[model samples]
Target: MIIKSPFTELANARQTPPSLVSEYDSCVDLIGCTSGQDGAHQAPGSQLAAKPHCMLALPGARNALTNAALAAYERYQMGQPDPRQLIDVLRFNVFYAFAHNAKVLGFNDDWLKYEAISPFGAPQPSPPSQPIAASCPANMKPTVLQMTVEHHPWIDFLPCPRMRDNFLRQVRDKGEDAVDEDGLCVDIVDAASARDPESVCLVTWGKPWVLSEWEVTEPFMKKWAWLLEGCTELMESTNTWRRKRGLHDIHFVH
Candidate 1:
């Protein structure tokens, strides 16, 4: 699952929120969230509410990331002991930012976490030969590639071997000036053009696949397939280019 033109991280001020939704109802059981819920009941509702570690993630009108971060912080303030892992939490948040809307994000201290690196798995493909803008410093581990699959008109123009009622499509209307995880904008177009797809190939079982094999199990995979299928249409679709590149989909520990 590689997004040639995924949304960029906001390295500066002002940002666009990623499309994330919360996993739970917007509230925490104050009486018992930490050492387990049973303790709060034992202490009486009023006494349990005084305990920390029970807060809700509410962003108000702010971007999803900020709102979630603040909510996570508030939960800690309520009695959530310091995990001394803000860095890990932040890094972990990045893992879920794209698809889910969460009020709290975890943090991490790893240099890789903040290096603007894409997720771990991308399939091997023809790398772009064109020179592009500067995204990372001279010596960076993973540079986002400019190659991408967008929702094209070809889907309507070309006859499809498979007609999908439900599908997933990742669109990158604006590239160069894109937003990052923190909701800041940066110039990533140049670095994107110089991408080498081989560097981010997807992993399957123990081997790397040049392309993501269709997943038979998950709904996310089904939508992802619609995205790829729309792009790989035999005819009718027009090809476009992305000015900036960032990591999307393709993540997890193998």
Candidate 2:
């Protein structure tokens, strides 16, 4: 069965006002997620956690994409292996620093797992213009778009430690005037746009065990809904743009 994405239709519509909590709640229910569940039908103790190949996504954070990237690490700590693909379903207000976070500690080589071009200067393949199947055979890997490549700059400085190190080296080599006097700030923003919806759309799906083991607070729930709305808008805008360009629309399937 094809799983319709709850988020693929908001790109062209006006963003729901933040004060519209009731509207947001209704929208979440429409998407098959209630207040505390990952999916509409996902129960207290299902088997999504036991699957060997797990999918994880992290929404970029405004204050710190680094902290948001740790969402994947935290999942790994809970026993799921590092996800093979990291998707940005929404625009980010900050640099793709989450790439650096994914490389934290001993996971340095983990960035190599994804199929997209490394922002660290690796060669880039053609951006995906077709609908990437979310299932195996067609969905083994996530799709990449030109916009995604253009928008996400983490590959240049975040994952490539040398890239960042080189920048610092340049700063020292060129002297403080290079940055301070030049008034240069290294800011990176991924493809997601502020005009689109949420600032960052980071999220992941876990099995019931993982969800059950996790703690949920009221504050976290409110934030979660807000973020979910952002993801929806991003997906909608992405697919709508793709369709307008005569490309296949994107979708996610469980």
Candidate 3:
């Protein structure tokens, strides 16, 4: 049985001919015509489009979310494993879009992890149970705390012994030049660095997914200064660039 979207009136009320309008309209039309008509009215027309291949828009808080879900599903069917399931993909896409947009808007750091408060540059308070005194030297008087200085923490920590051994093996295979920053791998390093800033795609979980940024070289973080935009802005920016190049946005396949 066909189910009508609860947002049908709201969608129509907006009257915005955004990029996803056609997709929504197409799906809505599909829902209305052959919702409960069984397989009898299954044809390609305004009144009978929802047939054996009935494509209902995925349930979501917004059409953009649904569109992203559809895109993720399409990508998964094409062999991308990051979006291995529907619900996970939907949640990830929403969060990704939110975080990406936030970075674009100048909130470049994670809100929960990174804090910006008064007394700038001062270290944040650690939990009482995890006192710094516990790790201090015996000669240092923990009771009468004086000025103390410590080396910066190492950011990269190899947690697994096997992984570390495997890394060393790989390094040995590559020779002394493996650890050199400006050695024979300079070209590779330069290529990777250059592509990060020059590429017009969003990277999620190591896989590249083309999101708006078309014609733009910088990542979304460096391009925009606010997270107040959504799919419409993305589509507009990318579509405008595509039109300039005599191309159009690619369609999603079921």
Index of the highest-lDDT prediction:
2
- RMSD of each candidate relative to the true structure: 21.6, 19.1, 24.0
- After superposition, candidate 3 runs with Cα above 4 Å error: 1-75, 79-84, 114-254
Pairs that collide in candidate 3 are 105-225, 105-226
Count clashing residue pairs in model 3: 2
- The per-candidate count of clashes, in order, stands at 39, 12, 2
Every candidate's lDDT: 0.21, 0.27, 0.25
Model 2 lDDT per residue over 1-254, tens place: 01112232222232221211111111110011112223222221232232221111223333333343344334434555232212222222122224323332112433333233333333444423333333322111222322232222233323222223333343345442332211112112333222222222222121111111111222222332322232333345335433432444543321
After best superposition, candidate 1 residue 197: deviation in angstroms? 29
* Residue 195 CA displacement from its true place in model 3, Å: 37
Q: Candidate 3 versus the native: TM-score?
A: 0.18
TM-score for each candidate, following the candidate numbering: 0.18, 0.21, 0.18
Q: What is the lDDT of residue 139 in candidate 1?
A: 19
lDDT of 1 by residue, 56-175 (tens): 112221243344444545545555523332322232222222112111111122211222221221133332222222431221212132123222111111112232111111123332
Ranked by TM-score, top first:
2, 1, 3
Off-target runs (Cα >4 Å) in candidate 1 are: 1-111, 114-171, 174-203, 212-216, 222-226, 231-254
Better of 1 and 2 by lDDT: 2
